[model samples]
Target chain A: MVAQIVFIIILLGAVYLFGKNVAKVRRNILLGRDTDRSDRPAERWAIMTKVALGQTKMVKRPIAAVMHFFIYVGFVIINLEVLEIMIDGIFGSHRIFSKPLGSLYGLLIGGFEVLALLVLVSCVVFLARRNILKLKRFSGTEMTAWPKSDANYILTIEILLMTAFLTMNAADYKLQLLHFGHYATAGSFPISGFIAPLLPSGPGALAGIERGCWWFHIIGILAFLNYLPYSKHFHILLAFPNVYYSNLKPKGEFTDMASVTNEVKAMLDPSFVPEPAEVSRFGVKDVTDLTWKNLMEAYTCTECGRCTSVCPANITGKLLSPRKIMMDTRDRLVEVGNNIDKHGKDYTDDKTLLDNYITREELWACTTCNACTEACPVNINPLEIITEMRRYVVMEESQAPASLNNMFGNMENNGAPWKYSQADRLNWAASDKVD
Target chain B: MEQKIPTMAEMAAEGNEPEILFWVGCAGSFDERAQKITRNICKILHHVGISYAVLGTEESCTGDPAKRAGNEFLFQMQAMVNIEVLNGYNIKKIVTGCPHCFNTIRNEYPGLGGTYEVIHHTQLIQGLIDEGKLKAEGGESFKGRKITFHDPCYLGRGNNVYEAPRAALEILDTELVEMKRCKSNGLCCGAGGAQMFKEPEKGNKDINDERMLDVIETGASVIASGCPFCMTMLTDGVKHMEKEQEIKVLDIAEITVRANGL
Candidate 1:
């Protein structure tokens, strides 16, 4: 009766927290204005195929890709095992799978244990690659605060979970041995088989150990579930749908400019044209400026730094780093969310928050090359955000690059960038021998 | 019927409801050789009994360069004005020798409420050949001389018409070699996006220079392109690298006109 009450309370608590966390993320995703360009069918297919199934961006780094694939697959397969563990904890029987299916469940648990070991080893390599090896790709790259510590904890939890599985398997193996008074299925649990000879031979003590191992496995899983929202492992839950609905537009396709009159009519009008008194303006200054999808992208960033590695600007000693952009956005969102929770919507001034978080030069430095967008493993389109900021800078404030100002002046007056007479447009063609 | 071969001026004068409007873009109106190619296209159209009208000086820049430079308002203004002018004449279809103009009028103009059925001169000429309205006289066969075709971005990827120019060259019996990155992935010729008018950005080498090197690597003696801007850029690249003798740049229209002995 005590176990049942504990199980129900823990299960309800986890479900509520999980739903709340995911709901907060969904709300954040919806807050941003619609910015997708889904005009072309081919473009949509290309994005879906490349980002969803191909996993092209992740494959750029083979070692990381292999490690991530195993972890991803293992996490998916192990969910059923988790449910079975919970049911077994509550009812004192692994009734989720019967006889032959139980044997298959055992095999699956064994396979997942091996995969979890591989994931732990791979994550160590990833750590060394980030910290000790200090790969140039990761140098000065922005990472989530406590990334190293979080990674270590996540890895430890995963290792502990696998260890619990093995311990429970070994205790079962010992019970089976003692029950039959022999070891016919000794080879079935190869790793656990060795533990039988070492364990005490009495049935009573072995049964006690079995109960203890069951508690360890169940508690370990529950603890891991509760810890997921606060760890980099959150991506494990978020990346699937993020990859599924990845933007599939052509590289240069921009969001349609809002119709001026419609935008005006939506605002309070004092003159012939209505100027929106509360226009959000272009460019993300803070978390609220980011669409809910952008917020989701920030949360889903695995801090892998693949985007920074391939950025041409970063390669050429530029101040812009795409990884930093995601990290910054994520940090700002958390800050704003905390403030809002504590003091409601009017807790902090939006302009002050934006000015402090995003810099003008950082916005201007982007080349709109689509390199960062192409490099992002999670399919985050940073270029679209940067371009929107650029549009705002150019249209609302009339602020642009000095060179562009001169060029725009020439285009307005001479109908070309050359500042020459419009008649001279064909001078280059005149010099060419057409026949 | 001994149909008259119209000069650009004569074509502009006919003023009838032509089945097609020949867009004598800025290049063809002022450039000598482009004008010659325009005249040849007119002659071909006459032989084929296809009535076409020429929009002479009335045609202006399609504002492609302006739009690419982030001058969206000016581009939209120019596009709106051009749409009004074209709509006034009920000009629903257009053929142009310039790929820049072809791409602008067909692709970009529609964003500002202008839409027209636009085709490049090569596409139209290829259509003429397909219908048996035009025939090629057997030339020196272009057999031994290795040749390659440069896919101009505006005509190829920007508009997604890759096969027509190659189809035209193949009919001329030329050995057509393709560069490593051709078609949609074709390298820019250090032109387009208004880069032709502005100073080239700071890079170790020009994109056109890089593209020309790719062409030379194919061991082609002649580089054929459809766009006049690409033609000039490639020609200049060849001359700058002193590969003038090794490679020649010719517009596919000029090449087709030669193959037809016009």
Candidate 2:
């Protein structure tokens, strides 16, 4: 009774805390401006299945894709074992499903054991890639200590949790072999059977070790669940919706500003009268000005740096890293969310996502090549945020670079970006240089 | 020879209408080097006997650079004015030499109520060759010369027209090569997103210089280009590397014209 009550308290506490964090994240994402992504249900479903569920995009880098496949599949299949553990924890029963499931229980547990071993091996390889190989994508200017540590910590925790699960199974198998109390010979331990011999033979010592491992495994999983919203690992949950809501149009099309359209209409025609304008800002000044889809995209970034690796500006040693852009957006958004929690919802912060986090140099360095968008496994569009900030810089403040200003002026006056008159528009046709 | 290229106004006034409208973009009109590409496109169109007319003085910038540079007001203004002129003529199909113009009119203009069938000149060339209107006959045989196609970001990834441009080259007898990054994974020639109008931000090397390394790796003697901005950047990159004598950066249309002896 005492053990079951303690398990119940811990389980409830973890659930409540995880629920609170998820709500906070949802609220923070909703803090941005509203835009509809509800259209094209059929297409969105197909894309979600292909990109998120099928992991099609992840296969672009075949080696990483194969390694990730093991971890992803293992995590999902092992969760079934977790369901059994949760039931066992609540009712203080040892392999309760064993009686009803009979022979099938052994097959299920045997499969999970094999997967646990694969997951363990994959984690070690991932750790070595980050620490020993020191891949360039993992060490960008924005990666700093915390982002690096976050990645390492998650991998380390998974290793510890997988260890606990296998050790618990091995101890249980040993107890069952001796036909100890309440320890039925139920599970077929293909992997744990090998480790059972390494354990001590005393029944009392084996029981204690099994109990300790069980508690540690379940508790570790609960802790990892809560850590997700705070870490880049949130993509495990957010990738589905993010890929589904990604821009469906051709990559070249930029969203037109409806407010700009109204203003231009009034200026062009004397008879045209526009509607009374609302308090509309030209473009994004902060997280609040961005669309909810854009904010969700920030939360979904995996920090994998695939986008950064393929980015033209970043590849050429420029200050613009698409991964860093997503990181900054997420950071600034969390700060804004915290500010709202401390103060009122309408409270203003002294800092913005513009000069305070992302600088003008980084924004201007982009070529808008859409490489980052194409490279993203989750279909996150960093170029959209970059262009939005550029709009705030130029349309709101009229502070575009001098060269761009010249090009704009030339387009307005000369019917082109150059200083030639429109009369010469047809001059190329008469030229004899047919090279 | 002074080519008699008829404007839409001239053709319309003569009680005749063209089957297609050739959008001679700003770079094609003003830039001295890009004009060579314009002439090559015209030679192919004229030789194929495709009835096309230019917009002439009525044509304006499609506002791609302005929108990309974050001046949406200027971009929309340019788009609206151009749409009106295009709508007035009841243009059903259009072709452009520049991907920037092609992208703006085909994709962005429709949202503002201007819609038409827009295609890049390379796609037009591919169609002409596919329909048996053009052929690689009597020109310099590039049988053994090494050539590679640089996928302009706007034309390749932006619009997903990779096969058309490659098809135009496949019909030639040249040993066509590919850069390390080509098609959807193509690297920019460092001239996109209004970066052409401004100096790049402080970096370890210029984007074109880095891209030139990819071009050099293919060991291609001739670099096939499509977009005007890419042509300028690649031509400059060849000069910067002092490989101007060994490598020639020619537009795809220019190559098609040479291949067909147009």
Candidate 3:
């Protein structure tokens, strides 16, 4: 009776904390401007399935894709065991399914053991790639202490959780071997059975070890769930929605702000002049100006640097790294979110998202090539953010580079980006050398 | 081919309807190198007997460069004026030698109420050949000469028309030599997203120079593309490498014109 009460309190506490964190993140994403993506439900569903659930783009890099596939699939399937763990924890029961499940329990446990082992192996390989090999993507200027450690922390957590799970199973199987009270000869531990003999034999010690692993495993999962909102691992949950909301229009299409376009239409009119439309700030000035989908995109970045690695601007050694662009957006988003949390909705601080974090140099370096968008495994569009920020710099501040100003001036005066008049546009056709 | 290239107003004055409006983009209308490609496309269009008319002086910039440079105001101004002209002429179809213009018209104009069936010249040439309106005679057989095709990022990736340009070039009676990065994975010729209108910021190497190295490695005697901006950039890249005589940077329209003995 006491044990069930204790379990209920701990479980309720974890549940409450996890719910609050998720709510905070949802609120943070909703703080951005509204964008209507309600059209084409069928297409969005297909995209979510193919990119996120199917992992179609992930396989572009064959080796890493294979390793990640094992980890991803293992993580998903292993969570089924968590359902039983929760039920067992809440009721203070041991091996609840072993009686009715018969050998099915053995098969299930055996499958989980195999997956757990694969997960552990992939985690070590990933750690080696990041730490010992010091892969270029894993150790750049952008990969600084917190981001780097965040990656390691999640991996280490997975390793610990899996170890505890297997250790618990091993101890339980040993108790079954000893034919202890109420211990059934049920589970077939393929991987953990070998380790069972090494564990301490006393009934009290065995119960202690099993009970300890059980508590640690459940608590570790809850902690990991809450940590997601603050880390790049948020992609694990947000990738589906991110790809679903990806801009499906032809990449060349730039989004026209309705306010700007409405005023622009009136400007094109010859005769009638109404009062000037109340123009708000052009482009993005803060996280608030960015669309909700853009915020979701920032949250969905995996920081894998695939986008950065494939970026032409980055490859050619430009200041633009698509990975850094996303990281900065996420960082600023967190900053703004915290500010709002402290000061309420209408808060005004001296800082803005534009210059406070992402720089003008980084925004200008992008060629808008769409390479970053294409290479993203989860369909995070960093190019969209860069272009949006560039829009901010150009339209809001009118502080474009001199050459761009010259081009814009030419476009305005000559109706083309060259200095020649529109009348002379056909002069190249009259050249005798052309024939 | 002394063809009568009527302007939209001239065609309307004659009380005739053109099959398509040939949008002679700013680059094709002004740039020295791009002009040659424009003439070649015109020759092929005439040979195929497609009833097409040029907007001539009536056409303004498509505002692609301006829009890409983040000047939405300038872009909309240019777009609204051009849309008025096209709609006044009741132009239903637009064919252009520039992918930048093609993309802006097909994608952007609809939001501001200008809509037309737009085609790149490569797609036009491929369509003509496919419809039996034009044919290749193998007279200017490029059998012995190696040729490679560069996918313009705007035409290939931006618009997803990779196969059409390749189909047009495949008429050469010899297979195209593939660059290390070709088709969807193709590199930009360093002139996209208004990068052509201004100089790129400082970097270790220019994208065009890196792209040129890909072209040089293929040992192609001719580099064919669909977009005029790419033609200009690749032509400059060829000169920078001092391989002007060794390799020719020509549009696929030019290739088809020469291949068909037009």
How good is chain A of candidate 3, measured by TM-score? 0.95
Per-residue lDDT, model 2, residue B149, is 92
DockQ of each: 0.12, 0.75, 0.60
- Give the C-alpha miss distance for residue A313 in model 3, angstroms: 1.2
TM-score of candidate 3 restricted to chain B?
0.97
- Give TM per candidate: 0.70, 0.98, 0.95
Model 1, TM vs. native: 0.70
Lowest summed-lDDT stretch of 10 residues in model 3 chain A?
A270-279
Query: Comparing candidate 2 with candidate 3, which one achieves the higher DockQ?
Result: 2
Scanning candidate 1 chain A in windows of ten residues, the lowest lDDT window is A260-269
Q: Where does candidate 2 stray beyond 4 Å?
A: A431-435
Q: For residues A210-245, could you state the per-residue lDDT of candidate 1 as single tens digits?
A: 667767767767677767766667777677567666
Taking the tens digit of each residue's C-alpha lDDT, what string does model 2 give over A1-435?
Answer: 899999999999999999999999999999988888999999999999999988998888898898898999999999988998899999999888889998999999999999999999999999999999999889899999999999999999999999898999999999998999989889899998888999999999999999999999999999999999999999999999999997999999999888898888888887888787667688877988999999999999989999999988998889999999999999999999999999978899799999999999999999999999988989999999999999999999999999999999899899898889988887777646444
Scored against the native two-chain complex, candidate 3 gets a DockQ of 0.60
Write down the lDDT of every candidate, Cα atoms only: 0.65, 0.91, 0.84
